[model samples]
Target: MFAGVDIGGTTTQVLLCTADLAVIDSTEVSTPAREGGQAMVRAALDALSVLRARVPSRLLGIGIGAAGVVDSRAGRILVASDSFRSWAGFEVTATVEKALGVPAFLDNDVNAFLRGEAAKGAVVDEPYVLGMTLGTGVGGALRLNGELLDGPHGAAGEVGHIPGFGDLPCTCGGRGHLETLASGRSIRARYGERTGRLLTARGVAEAAADGDPDALAVYEAAGAGVARAILITAGLLDITTVVVGGGVSRAWDLIQPPMLAELTAGPPVSGHPIRVVRARLGSGAVAIGAASRARTELDAVTRV
Candidate 1:
Protein backbone atom coordinates (compact mmCIF):
# COMPACT_ATOMS: atom_id res chain seq x y z
CA MET A 1 0.00 0.00 0.00
CA PHE A 2 0.94 3.61 -0.44
CA ALA A 3 0.49 6.40 2.11
CA GLY A 4 -1.14 9.80 1.71
CA VAL A 5 -0.85 12.63 4.22
CA ASP A 6 -3.06 15.72 4.27
CA ILE A 7 -1.93 18.43 6.70
CA GLY A 8 -4.35 21.19 7.50
CA GLY A 9 -4.59 24.17 9.84
CA THR A 10 -6.25 22.27 12.69
CA THR A 11 -5.77 18.61 11.80
CA THR A 12 -3.69 16.18 9.82
CA GLN A 13 -4.86 12.95 8.23
CA VAL A 14 -2.93 9.99 6.89
CA LEU A 15 -4.12 6.98 4.96
CA LEU A 16 -2.89 3.82 3.30
CA CYS A 17 -4.61 2.66 0.17
CA THR A 18 -4.59 0.15 -2.68
CA ALA A 19 -3.63 1.12 -6.21
CA ASP A 20 -7.21 1.95 -7.16
CA LEU A 21 -7.57 4.29 -4.13
CA ALA A 22 -9.52 2.05 -1.80
CA VAL A 23 -8.47 3.02 1.70
CA ILE A 24 -6.94 0.19 3.68
CA ASP A 25 -6.03 2.07 6.86
CA SER A 26 -6.20 5.64 8.09
CA THR A 27 -5.38 7.99 11.00
CA GLU A 28 -6.19 11.54 12.00
CA VAL A 29 -4.28 13.75 14.44
CA SER A 30 -3.99 17.31 15.64
CA THR A 31 -1.76 19.76 13.77
CA PRO A 32 1.18 20.98 15.86
CA ALA A 33 1.23 24.72 15.28
CA ARG A 34 3.10 25.76 18.40
CA GLU A 35 5.69 23.13 17.55
CA GLY A 36 5.81 24.44 13.97
CA GLY A 37 6.55 22.66 10.67
CA GLN A 38 9.14 20.19 11.90
CA ALA A 39 6.93 19.11 14.74
CA MET A 40 4.02 18.84 12.35
CA VAL A 41 6.09 16.53 10.15
CA ARG A 42 6.88 14.39 13.17
CA ALA A 43 3.19 14.22 13.98
CA ALA A 44 2.41 13.11 10.43
CA LEU A 45 4.96 10.30 10.66
CA ASP A 46 3.46 9.34 13.98
CA ALA A 47 0.00 9.16 12.43
CA LEU A 48 1.13 6.14 10.46
CA SER A 49 3.30 4.72 13.20
CA VAL A 50 1.04 1.70 13.60
CA LEU A 51 0.70 0.85 9.91
CA ARG A 52 3.75 -1.44 9.82
CA ALA A 53 1.76 -4.38 11.15
CA ARG A 54 -0.93 -4.02 8.51
CA VAL A 55 1.34 -3.89 5.48
CA PRO A 56 3.33 -6.64 3.78
CA SER A 57 6.63 -4.78 3.96
CA ARG A 58 7.82 -1.29 4.58
CA LEU A 59 4.89 0.58 3.02
CA LEU A 60 5.19 2.53 -0.19
CA GLY A 61 6.46 6.12 -0.24
CA ILE A 62 4.39 8.96 1.24
CA GLY A 63 2.58 11.83 -0.47
CA ILE A 64 1.85 14.98 1.52
CA GLY A 65 -1.00 17.35 0.83
CA ALA A 66 -0.07 20.41 2.86
CA ALA A 67 -1.75 23.78 3.44
CA GLY A 68 -0.41 26.79 1.49
CA VAL A 69 1.59 27.10 -1.72
CA VAL A 70 3.38 23.79 -2.31
CA ASP A 71 5.88 23.20 -5.06
CA SER A 72 4.78 19.73 -6.06
CA ARG A 73 7.62 19.36 -8.54
CA ALA A 74 10.24 20.32 -5.96
CA GLY A 75 8.46 18.75 -2.96
CA ARG A 76 8.59 21.97 -0.93
CA ILE A 77 6.14 24.05 1.06
CA LEU A 78 6.56 27.50 -0.47
CA VAL A 79 4.09 29.68 1.42
CA ALA A 80 3.49 30.20 5.10
CA SER A 81 0.97 32.27 7.03
CA ASP A 82 -0.22 32.58 10.61
CA SER A 83 -2.19 29.37 10.14
CA PHE A 84 0.85 27.45 8.91
CA ARG A 85 3.73 29.34 10.45
CA SER A 86 6.02 26.32 10.52
CA TRP A 87 5.54 25.42 6.85
CA ALA A 88 6.94 28.49 5.10
CA GLY A 89 9.99 27.63 3.04
CA PHE A 90 10.10 24.09 4.46
CA GLU A 91 11.14 21.27 2.15
CA VAL A 92 8.59 18.96 3.69
CA THR A 93 8.68 16.20 1.08
CA ALA A 94 12.45 15.82 1.36
CA THR A 95 12.35 15.95 5.15
CA VAL A 96 9.68 13.27 5.36
CA GLU A 97 11.41 11.12 2.75
CA LYS A 98 14.74 11.33 4.58
CA ALA A 99 13.18 10.79 7.99
CA LEU A 100 10.96 7.91 6.89
CA GLY A 101 13.02 6.58 3.98
CA VAL A 102 10.28 6.85 1.33
CA PRO A 103 9.47 9.02 -1.67
CA ALA A 104 6.74 11.68 -1.28
CA PHE A 105 4.65 13.80 -3.58
CA LEU A 106 3.89 17.23 -2.10
CA ASP A 107 1.15 19.70 -3.05
CA ASN A 108 -0.84 22.60 -1.67
CA ASP A 109 -3.68 21.52 0.60
CA VAL A 110 -6.50 22.95 -1.56
CA ASN A 111 -5.00 21.48 -4.68
CA ALA A 112 -4.82 18.10 -3.00
CA PHE A 113 -8.37 18.47 -1.76
CA LEU A 114 -9.65 19.19 -5.25
CA ARG A 115 -7.65 16.39 -6.74
CA GLY A 116 -9.11 14.03 -4.17
CA GLU A 117 -12.66 15.12 -4.87
CA ALA A 118 -12.26 15.04 -8.59
CA ALA A 119 -10.42 11.74 -8.62
CA LYS A 120 -12.88 9.89 -6.41
CA GLY A 121 -15.31 12.12 -4.56
CA ALA A 122 -17.72 14.88 -5.56
CA VAL A 123 -16.42 16.40 -8.78
CA VAL A 124 -15.06 13.26 -10.34
CA ASP A 125 -15.60 13.18 -14.13
CA GLU A 126 -16.86 16.73 -14.20
CA PRO A 127 -15.63 18.78 -17.14
CA TYR A 128 -14.70 21.78 -14.98
CA VAL A 129 -14.62 22.59 -11.27
CA LEU A 130 -13.70 25.38 -8.90
CA GLY A 131 -13.12 24.10 -5.40
CA MET A 132 -13.22 26.69 -2.63
CA THR A 133 -12.64 26.04 1.06
CA LEU A 134 -14.11 28.51 3.57
CA GLY A 135 -12.18 27.52 6.65
CA THR A 136 -9.76 29.85 8.50
CA GLY A 137 -9.27 31.55 5.17
CA VAL A 138 -10.43 31.13 1.59
CA GLY A 139 -8.48 28.49 -0.36
CA GLY A 140 -9.33 27.66 -3.96
CA ALA A 141 -8.43 25.42 -6.92
CA LEU A 142 -9.50 25.01 -10.52
CA ARG A 143 -9.76 21.84 -12.54
CA LEU A 144 -10.16 22.50 -16.24
CA ASN A 145 -10.66 19.74 -18.76
CA GLY A 146 -9.66 17.29 -16.03
CA GLU A 147 -6.36 18.98 -15.23
CA LEU A 148 -5.38 21.18 -12.27
CA LEU A 149 -4.62 24.77 -13.20
CA ASP A 150 -1.72 25.24 -10.81
CA GLY A 151 -0.05 27.79 -13.18
CA PRO A 152 3.66 28.04 -13.78
CA HIS A 153 4.32 29.69 -10.41
CA GLY A 154 2.02 27.27 -8.59
CA ALA A 155 -0.34 30.10 -7.66
CA ALA A 156 -3.01 29.92 -10.34
CA GLY A 157 -6.14 29.21 -8.32
CA GLU A 158 -5.36 31.52 -5.41
CA VAL A 159 -8.58 33.54 -5.36
CA GLY A 160 -7.99 34.86 -1.85
CA HIS A 161 -5.87 37.79 -2.97
CA ILE A 162 -8.17 39.19 -5.66
CA PRO A 163 -8.39 42.97 -5.70
CA GLY A 164 -11.35 45.44 -5.55
CA PHE A 165 -12.58 43.98 -2.28
CA GLY A 166 -13.28 45.71 1.03
CA ASP A 167 -11.03 46.95 3.82
CA LEU A 168 -10.62 43.61 5.54
CA PRO A 169 -6.99 42.46 5.83
CA CYS A 170 -5.79 39.04 4.63
CA THR A 171 -3.31 36.78 6.35
CA CYS A 172 -1.35 36.87 3.10
CA GLY A 173 -0.51 40.54 3.82
CA GLY A 174 -3.13 41.94 1.51
CA ARG A 175 -6.18 44.14 2.00
CA GLY A 176 -9.69 43.50 0.63
CA HIS A 177 -8.95 39.92 -0.33
CA LEU A 178 -11.78 37.38 -0.34
CA GLU A 179 -10.50 35.67 2.82
CA THR A 180 -11.16 38.84 4.87
CA LEU A 181 -14.80 38.64 3.82
CA ALA A 182 -15.48 34.91 3.44
CA SER A 183 -13.31 32.94 5.87
CA GLY A 184 -14.75 31.46 9.08
CA ARG A 185 -12.56 33.74 11.20
CA SER A 186 -13.62 36.76 9.20
CA ILE A 187 -17.31 35.85 9.50
CA ARG A 188 -17.13 35.41 13.25
CA ALA A 189 -15.03 38.53 13.72
CA ARG A 190 -17.27 40.63 11.56
CA TYR A 191 -20.49 39.37 13.13
CA GLY A 192 -19.11 39.32 16.65
CA GLU A 193 -17.99 42.91 16.38
CA ARG A 194 -21.25 43.99 14.85
CA THR A 195 -23.69 41.84 16.84
CA GLY A 196 -21.54 41.55 19.97
CA ARG A 197 -22.27 37.86 20.25
CA LEU A 198 -18.67 36.56 20.06
CA LEU A 199 -19.94 33.51 18.23
CA THR A 200 -17.76 31.37 16.02
CA ALA A 201 -18.68 30.91 12.38
CA ARG A 202 -20.22 27.56 13.15
CA GLY A 203 -22.13 29.06 16.04
CA VAL A 204 -23.31 31.88 13.83
CA ALA A 205 -24.65 29.33 11.36
CA GLU A 206 -26.54 27.62 14.13
CA ALA A 207 -27.87 30.95 15.24
CA ALA A 208 -28.94 31.69 11.71
CA ALA A 209 -30.62 28.34 11.55
CA ASP A 210 -32.43 29.40 14.70
CA GLY A 211 -33.70 32.48 12.81
CA ASP A 212 -31.48 35.04 14.43
CA PRO A 213 -31.71 37.89 11.92
CA ASP A 214 -28.33 39.39 12.73
CA ALA A 215 -26.61 36.04 12.42
CA LEU A 216 -28.51 35.34 9.24
CA ALA A 217 -27.40 38.64 7.80
CA VAL A 218 -23.80 37.79 8.59
CA TYR A 219 -24.06 34.67 6.45
CA GLU A 220 -25.84 36.60 3.74
CA ALA A 221 -22.99 39.07 3.47
CA ALA A 222 -20.52 36.26 3.44
CA GLY A 223 -22.34 34.51 0.63
CA ALA A 224 -22.50 37.72 -1.29
CA GLY A 225 -18.76 38.21 -0.89
CA VAL A 226 -18.10 34.67 -2.03
CA ALA A 227 -20.43 35.19 -4.96
CA ARG A 228 -18.42 38.18 -6.07
CA ALA A 229 -15.22 36.20 -5.98
CA ILE A 230 -16.75 33.14 -7.62
CA LEU A 231 -18.31 35.18 -10.35
CA ILE A 232 -15.00 36.79 -11.13
CA THR A 233 -13.29 33.45 -11.11
CA ALA A 234 -15.88 31.85 -13.37
CA GLY A 235 -15.91 34.76 -15.75
CA LEU A 236 -12.18 34.71 -16.15
CA LEU A 237 -11.89 30.94 -16.26
CA ASP A 238 -15.22 29.74 -17.77
CA ILE A 239 -15.83 27.27 -15.01
CA THR A 240 -19.33 26.22 -14.00
CA THR A 241 -19.09 23.94 -11.01
CA VAL A 242 -18.24 25.47 -7.62
CA VAL A 243 -17.87 23.00 -4.80
CA VAL A 244 -17.93 24.92 -1.51
CA GLY A 245 -16.04 23.16 1.26
CA GLY A 246 -14.72 23.72 4.83
CA GLY A 247 -16.34 24.93 8.08
CA VAL A 248 -18.61 27.30 6.18
CA SER A 249 -20.26 24.38 4.39
CA ARG A 250 -21.83 23.52 7.76
CA ALA A 251 -23.78 26.76 7.43
CA TRP A 252 -25.25 25.84 4.08
CA ASP A 253 -28.76 26.33 5.31
CA LEU A 254 -28.05 30.02 5.75
CA ILE A 255 -25.48 30.56 3.03
CA GLN A 256 -26.63 28.54 0.00
CA PRO A 257 -29.70 30.51 -0.97
CA PRO A 258 -27.90 33.82 -0.90
CA MET A 259 -24.83 32.43 -2.56
CA LEU A 260 -26.96 31.08 -5.40
CA ALA A 261 -28.86 34.31 -5.69
CA GLU A 262 -25.63 36.21 -6.26
CA LEU A 263 -24.47 33.72 -8.85
CA THR A 264 -27.77 33.90 -10.69
CA ALA A 265 -27.74 37.66 -10.57
CA GLY A 266 -25.14 37.43 -13.31
CA PRO A 267 -21.73 39.03 -13.44
CA PRO A 268 -21.16 42.32 -15.20
CA VAL A 269 -19.60 40.54 -18.16
CA SER A 270 -20.97 37.00 -18.24
CA GLY A 271 -24.47 35.57 -17.88
CA HIS A 272 -23.64 31.87 -17.94
CA PRO A 273 -25.35 29.75 -15.32
CA ILE A 274 -22.76 28.49 -12.84
CA ARG A 275 -23.87 25.81 -10.45
CA VAL A 276 -22.89 26.38 -6.82
CA VAL A 277 -23.20 23.46 -4.45
CA ARG A 278 -21.91 22.05 -1.16
CA ALA A 279 -18.86 19.81 -1.14
CA ARG A 280 -19.95 16.18 -1.19
CA LEU A 281 -17.22 14.73 1.02
CA GLY A 282 -17.15 17.56 3.56
CA SER A 283 -13.81 17.80 5.43
CA GLY A 284 -12.65 14.36 4.40
CA ALA A 285 -11.84 15.43 0.85
CA VAL A 286 -8.23 16.20 1.71
CA ALA A 287 -7.55 12.89 3.44
CA ILE A 288 -9.36 11.05 0.69
CA GLY A 289 -7.27 12.85 -1.91
CA ALA A 290 -4.08 12.17 -0.02
CA ALA A 291 -5.12 8.57 0.06
CA SER A 292 -5.66 8.71 -3.65
CA ARG A 293 -2.13 9.95 -4.12
CA ALA A 294 -0.81 7.19 -1.89
CA ARG A 295 -2.63 4.68 -3.99
CA THR A 296 -0.67 5.88 -6.99
CA GLU A 297 2.56 5.16 -5.14
CA LEU A 298 1.35 1.71 -4.21
CA ASP A 299 1.05 0.81 -7.88
CA ALA A 300 4.53 2.11 -8.61
CA VAL A 301 6.06 0.18 -5.71
CA THR A 302 4.42 -3.09 -6.69
CA ARG A 303 5.63 -2.55 -10.24
CA VAL A 304 9.19 -1.94 -9.07
Candidate 2:
Protein backbone atom coordinates (compact mmCIF):
# COMPACT_ATOMS: atom_id res chain seq x y z
CA MET A 1 0.00 0.00 0.00
CA PHE A 2 0.98 3.65 -0.44
CA ALA A 3 -0.23 6.89 1.07
CA GLY A 4 -0.95 10.28 -0.45
CA VAL A 5 -1.59 13.64 1.15
CA ASP A 6 -3.01 16.80 -0.40
CA ILE A 7 -2.43 19.89 1.72
CA GLY A 8 -4.64 22.82 0.81
CA GLY A 9 -5.09 26.16 2.52
CA THR A 10 -8.18 25.16 4.48
CA THR A 11 -7.94 21.39 4.69
CA THR A 12 -5.65 18.46 4.13
CA GLN A 13 -6.67 15.09 2.67
CA VAL A 14 -5.09 11.70 3.20
CA LEU A 15 -5.65 8.77 0.87
CA LEU A 16 -4.65 5.14 1.04
CA CYS A 17 -4.33 3.00 -2.04
CA THR A 18 -3.15 -0.37 -3.27
CA ALA A 19 -0.06 -0.85 -5.36
CA ASP A 20 -2.20 -0.96 -8.50
CA LEU A 21 -3.74 2.43 -7.67
CA ALA A 22 -7.13 1.32 -6.38
CA VAL A 23 -8.14 3.64 -3.59
CA ILE A 24 -8.98 1.94 -0.29
CA ASP A 25 -9.92 4.83 1.94
CA SER A 26 -9.50 8.57 2.54
CA THR A 27 -9.74 11.17 5.30
CA GLU A 28 -9.83 14.92 5.63
CA VAL A 29 -8.52 17.17 8.37
CA SER A 30 -8.29 20.90 8.95
CA THR A 31 -4.94 22.29 7.90
CA PRO A 32 -3.07 24.09 10.65
CA ALA A 33 -1.47 26.35 8.10
CA ARG A 34 -1.39 29.46 10.26
CA GLU A 35 0.73 27.72 12.87
CA GLY A 36 3.43 27.08 10.24
CA GLY A 37 4.70 24.10 8.24
CA GLN A 38 5.55 21.94 11.24
CA ALA A 39 2.03 22.24 12.56
CA MET A 40 0.66 21.44 9.12
CA VAL A 41 2.84 18.34 8.95
CA ARG A 42 1.54 17.23 12.31
CA ALA A 43 -2.03 17.59 11.06
CA ALA A 44 -1.21 15.42 8.06
CA LEU A 45 0.34 12.83 10.32
CA ASP A 46 -2.76 12.83 12.47
CA ALA A 47 -4.87 12.22 9.39
CA LEU A 48 -2.57 9.45 8.31
CA SER A 49 -2.89 7.88 11.75
CA VAL A 50 -6.65 7.83 11.43
CA LEU A 51 -6.46 6.31 7.96
CA ARG A 52 -4.01 3.68 9.15
CA ALA A 53 -6.34 2.66 11.93
CA ARG A 54 -9.12 2.16 9.40
CA VAL A 55 -7.11 0.14 6.88
CA PRO A 56 -4.29 -1.39 8.95
CA SER A 57 -2.05 -1.83 5.92
CA ARG A 58 1.70 -1.47 5.68
CA LEU A 59 2.46 1.64 3.64
CA LEU A 60 5.34 1.60 1.22
CA GLY A 61 5.86 5.36 1.15
CA ILE A 62 4.04 8.66 1.25
CA GLY A 63 3.66 11.38 -1.37
CA ILE A 64 2.41 14.89 -0.83
CA GLY A 65 0.81 17.48 -3.09
CA ALA A 66 0.99 20.87 -1.46
CA ALA A 67 -0.07 24.37 -2.40
CA GLY A 68 3.16 26.21 -3.06
CA VAL A 69 6.16 26.54 -5.33
CA VAL A 70 7.67 23.21 -4.27
CA ASP A 71 11.12 22.01 -5.15
CA SER A 72 10.23 18.35 -5.62
CA ARG A 73 13.84 17.19 -5.85
CA ALA A 74 14.76 18.63 -2.49
CA GLY A 75 11.26 18.29 -1.00
CA ARG A 76 11.28 21.95 -0.06
CA ILE A 77 8.59 24.59 -0.29
CA LEU A 78 10.42 27.33 -2.17
CA VAL A 79 7.59 29.82 -1.76
CA ALA A 80 4.18 29.75 -0.13
CA SER A 81 1.19 31.98 0.48
CA ASP A 82 0.66 33.97 3.65
CA SER A 83 -2.04 31.46 4.58
CA PHE A 84 0.87 29.20 5.49
CA ARG A 85 3.03 31.43 7.63
CA SER A 86 6.70 30.46 7.73
CA TRP A 87 6.13 27.60 5.28
CA ALA A 88 8.82 28.46 2.78
CA GLY A 89 12.23 26.80 3.26
CA PHE A 90 10.72 23.88 5.19
CA GLU A 91 12.15 20.49 4.30
CA VAL A 92 8.82 18.75 3.84
CA THR A 93 10.02 15.41 2.48
CA ALA A 94 12.67 14.85 5.10
CA THR A 95 10.39 15.91 7.89
CA VAL A 96 7.57 13.62 6.79
CA GLU A 97 9.91 10.73 6.12
CA LYS A 98 11.48 11.09 9.52
CA ALA A 99 8.15 11.33 11.28
CA LEU A 100 6.63 8.30 9.54
CA GLY A 101 9.82 6.29 9.13
CA VAL A 102 9.00 5.87 5.45
CA PRO A 103 10.14 7.56 2.26
CA ALA A 104 8.19 10.67 1.31
CA PHE A 105 7.95 12.68 -1.87
CA LEU A 106 6.56 16.16 -2.42
CA ASP A 107 5.26 18.18 -5.36
CA ASN A 108 3.24 21.23 -6.16
CA ASP A 109 -0.49 20.51 -5.93
CA VAL A 110 -1.09 21.67 -9.50
CA ASN A 111 1.59 19.33 -10.79
CA ALA A 112 -0.06 16.44 -9.00
CA PHE A 113 -3.43 17.48 -10.43
CA LEU A 114 -2.03 17.36 -13.96
CA ARG A 115 -0.32 14.05 -13.28
CA GLY A 116 -3.59 12.44 -12.16
CA GLU A 117 -5.52 13.77 -15.15
CA ALA A 118 -2.89 12.82 -17.67
CA ALA A 119 -2.40 9.36 -16.22
CA LYS A 120 -5.98 8.32 -15.55
CA GLY A 121 -8.58 11.06 -15.71
CA ALA A 122 -9.24 13.83 -18.23
CA VAL A 123 -6.73 14.07 -21.08
CA VAL A 124 -5.80 10.45 -20.51
CA ASP A 125 -3.48 9.05 -23.18
CA GLU A 126 -2.67 12.60 -24.20
CA PRO A 127 0.94 13.38 -23.45
CA TYR A 128 0.68 17.13 -24.02
CA VAL A 129 -2.02 19.01 -22.13
CA LEU A 130 -2.55 22.11 -20.03
CA GLY A 131 -4.22 21.75 -16.64
CA MET A 132 -5.83 24.70 -14.83
CA THR A 133 -7.59 24.88 -11.48
CA LEU A 134 -9.77 27.90 -10.62
CA GLY A 135 -10.23 27.75 -6.86
CA THR A 136 -9.29 30.16 -4.05
CA GLY A 137 -6.37 30.86 -6.34
CA VAL A 138 -5.69 30.04 -9.95
CA GLY A 139 -3.14 27.29 -10.58
CA GLY A 140 -1.74 25.63 -13.69
CA ALA A 141 0.33 22.60 -14.71
CA LEU A 142 1.88 21.44 -17.94
CA ARG A 143 2.29 17.88 -19.18
CA LEU A 144 4.66 17.41 -22.10
CA ASN A 145 5.51 14.04 -23.63
CA GLY A 146 3.99 12.21 -20.66
CA GLU A 147 5.90 14.13 -18.00
CA LEU A 148 4.99 16.98 -15.67
CA LEU A 149 6.91 20.15 -16.56
CA ASP A 150 8.78 21.10 -13.38
CA GLY A 151 10.84 24.07 -14.45
CA PRO A 152 14.18 25.04 -12.96
CA HIS A 153 12.42 27.46 -10.61
CA GLY A 154 9.61 24.99 -9.87
CA ALA A 155 7.20 27.61 -11.27
CA ALA A 156 6.94 26.67 -14.92
CA GLY A 157 3.21 26.05 -15.11
CA GLU A 158 2.17 29.00 -12.95
CA VAL A 159 0.09 30.76 -15.62
CA GLY A 160 -2.03 32.46 -12.98
CA HIS A 161 0.87 34.75 -12.04
CA ILE A 162 1.50 35.91 -15.60
CA PRO A 163 1.50 39.70 -15.92
CA GLY A 164 0.00 42.06 -18.53
CA PHE A 165 -3.44 41.70 -16.96
CA GLY A 166 -5.47 44.51 -15.37
CA ASP A 167 -4.06 46.60 -12.50
CA LEU A 168 -5.72 44.61 -9.71
CA PRO A 169 -3.27 43.58 -7.00
CA CYS A 170 -2.61 39.86 -6.50
CA THR A 171 -2.09 37.89 -3.30
CA CYS A 172 1.51 37.33 -4.36
CA GLY A 173 2.10 41.10 -4.06
CA GLY A 174 2.01 41.49 -7.81
CA ARG A 175 -0.13 43.70 -9.99
CA GLY A 176 -1.86 42.69 -13.22
CA HIS A 177 -1.70 38.94 -12.57
CA LEU A 178 -4.23 36.51 -14.03
CA GLU A 179 -5.16 35.38 -10.49
CA THR A 180 -6.68 38.84 -9.92
CA LEU A 181 -9.44 38.01 -12.41
CA ALA A 182 -9.67 34.29 -13.04
CA SER A 183 -9.72 32.79 -9.56
CA GLY A 184 -12.77 32.01 -7.39
CA ARG A 185 -11.60 34.54 -4.80
CA SER A 186 -11.41 37.17 -7.52
CA ILE A 187 -14.88 36.27 -8.76
CA ARG A 188 -16.37 36.77 -5.33
CA ALA A 189 -14.37 39.92 -4.72
CA ARG A 190 -15.45 41.45 -8.01
CA TYR A 191 -19.09 40.62 -7.33
CA GLY A 192 -18.91 42.04 -3.80
CA GLU A 193 -17.34 45.24 -5.10
CA ARG A 194 -20.11 45.73 -7.68
CA THR A 195 -23.13 44.73 -5.58
CA GLY A 196 -21.86 45.81 -2.14
CA ARG A 197 -22.70 42.35 -0.81
CA LEU A 198 -20.27 39.71 0.35
CA LEU A 199 -21.13 36.25 -0.94
CA THR A 200 -19.37 33.01 -1.70
CA ALA A 201 -18.35 32.24 -5.24
CA ARG A 202 -21.14 29.67 -5.36
CA GLY A 203 -23.61 32.35 -4.35
CA VAL A 204 -22.38 34.50 -7.20
CA ALA A 205 -22.92 31.55 -9.53
CA GLU A 206 -26.45 31.11 -8.24
CA ALA A 207 -27.12 34.80 -8.85
CA ALA A 208 -25.75 34.47 -12.37
CA ALA A 209 -28.04 31.51 -12.95
CA ASP A 210 -30.91 33.77 -11.82
CA GLY A 211 -29.89 36.19 -14.59
CA ASP A 212 -28.46 38.96 -12.46
CA PRO A 213 -26.62 41.27 -14.83
CA ASP A 214 -23.95 42.26 -12.34
CA ALA A 215 -23.21 38.69 -11.41
CA LEU A 216 -23.19 37.74 -15.06
CA ALA A 217 -20.66 40.47 -15.75
CA VAL A 218 -18.35 39.18 -13.05
CA TYR A 219 -18.41 35.67 -14.43
CA GLU A 220 -17.95 36.95 -17.95
CA ALA A 221 -14.91 38.91 -16.91
CA ALA A 222 -13.53 35.81 -15.27
CA GLY A 223 -14.16 33.86 -18.45
CA ALA A 224 -12.44 36.47 -20.51
CA GLY A 225 -9.43 36.39 -18.21
CA VAL A 226 -9.25 32.62 -18.49
CA ALA A 227 -9.56 32.89 -22.25
CA ARG A 228 -6.71 35.36 -22.37
CA ALA A 229 -4.55 33.05 -20.26
CA ILE A 230 -5.40 30.09 -22.46
CA LEU A 231 -4.52 31.99 -25.59
CA ILE A 232 -1.23 33.07 -24.09
CA THR A 233 -0.45 29.47 -23.17
CA ALA A 234 -1.32 28.29 -26.65
CA GLY A 235 0.75 30.97 -28.32
CA LEU A 236 3.84 30.09 -26.36
CA LEU A 237 3.59 26.31 -26.12
CA ASP A 238 1.22 25.43 -28.98
CA ILE A 239 -0.73 23.24 -26.53
CA THR A 240 -4.34 22.82 -27.62
CA THR A 241 -5.96 20.86 -24.83
CA VAL A 242 -6.81 22.59 -21.57
CA VAL A 243 -8.47 20.72 -18.71
CA VAL A 244 -9.99 23.01 -16.08
CA GLY A 245 -11.33 22.15 -12.64
CA GLY A 246 -11.88 23.49 -9.08
CA GLY A 247 -14.63 25.38 -7.27
CA VAL A 248 -15.08 28.12 -9.86
CA SER A 249 -15.35 25.70 -12.76
CA ARG A 250 -18.51 24.29 -11.19
CA ALA A 251 -20.11 27.41 -12.68
CA TRP A 252 -19.24 26.28 -16.18
CA ASP A 253 -22.65 27.32 -17.46
CA LEU A 254 -22.02 30.95 -16.55
CA ILE A 255 -18.42 31.08 -17.77
CA GLN A 256 -18.32 28.95 -20.94
CA PRO A 257 -20.11 31.34 -23.27
CA PRO A 258 -17.92 34.35 -22.61
CA MET A 259 -14.83 32.16 -22.52
CA LEU A 260 -15.68 30.57 -25.87
CA ALA A 261 -16.54 33.94 -27.36
CA GLU A 262 -13.15 35.32 -26.43
CA LEU A 263 -11.40 32.22 -27.64
CA THR A 264 -13.25 32.48 -30.93
CA ALA A 265 -12.20 36.10 -31.33
CA GLY A 266 -8.55 35.63 -30.49
CA PRO A 267 -5.97 35.79 -33.27
CA PRO A 268 -5.09 32.50 -34.92
CA VAL A 269 -1.92 30.87 -33.74
CA SER A 270 -0.16 27.53 -34.30
CA GLY A 271 -2.65 25.95 -31.90
CA HIS A 272 -5.52 28.02 -33.21
CA PRO A 273 -8.43 25.97 -31.91
CA ILE A 274 -8.08 25.36 -28.17
CA ARG A 275 -10.15 22.77 -26.41
CA VAL A 276 -11.05 23.68 -22.83
CA VAL A 277 -12.87 21.07 -20.79
CA ARG A 278 -13.45 20.08 -17.15
CA ALA A 279 -11.44 17.58 -15.18
CA ARG A 280 -12.93 14.11 -14.71
CA LEU A 281 -11.30 13.14 -11.42
CA GLY A 282 -13.22 15.66 -9.33
CA SER A 283 -11.89 15.96 -5.74
CA GLY A 284 -9.62 12.92 -5.82
CA ALA A 285 -7.13 13.94 -8.51
CA VAL A 286 -4.48 15.30 -6.25
CA ALA A 287 -4.45 12.28 -3.95
CA ILE A 288 -4.34 9.81 -6.78
CA GLY A 289 -1.58 11.72 -8.49
CA ALA A 290 0.37 11.93 -5.27
CA ALA A 291 0.10 8.17 -4.85
CA SER A 292 1.29 7.69 -8.38
CA ARG A 293 4.21 9.93 -7.58
CA ALA A 294 5.05 7.79 -4.56
CA ARG A 295 5.00 4.70 -6.71
CA THR A 296 7.24 6.38 -9.24
CA GLU A 297 9.68 7.35 -6.53
CA LEU A 298 9.70 3.84 -5.13
CA ASP A 299 10.39 2.38 -8.55
CA ALA A 300 13.20 4.83 -9.15
CA VAL A 301 14.82 4.02 -5.83
CA THR A 302 14.54 0.30 -6.49
CA ARG A 303 16.20 0.69 -9.87
CA VAL A 304 19.02 2.76 -8.44
Clashing residue pairs in candidate 1 are none
lDDT per residue (tens digit) for residues 1-304 in model 1: 6788888878988887765667788778999976788999999888787665666555666778888887878878777777666678888878888887877788788887887888877787887888898898889998999878888778888887786678877788888898887889888998887887798888888888899888888889888888888888887888978888888878787778888888777753656688777787766678777666656655667899
Ten-residue stretch with the least lDDT total in model 1: 51-60
- Give candidates' CA RMSD values in order: 2.3, 1.3
User: How do the predictions measure up, each by TM-score?
Assistant: 0.92, 0.97
Model 2 agreement with the true structure over 1-304: per-residue lDDT tens digits: 9998899999898999998778899989999889999999999999899899999989899989999999999999999988889899999999999999999999999898887787678888877688999999999999887788999989988989999888999999999999998888998899999999998999999999999999999999999988899888888887868999888999999878999999998853873588888898888888888988999889988999
Q: After superposing candidate 1 on the true structure, give the runs of residues whose Cα lies further than 4 Å from its correct spot.
A: 55-58, 267-270, 294-304
Clashes (candidate 1): 0
lDDT of 2 at 169: 98
Instruction: Give the local distance difference test score of model 1.
Output: 0.80
- The models' CA-based lDDT, in order, is 0.80, 0.90
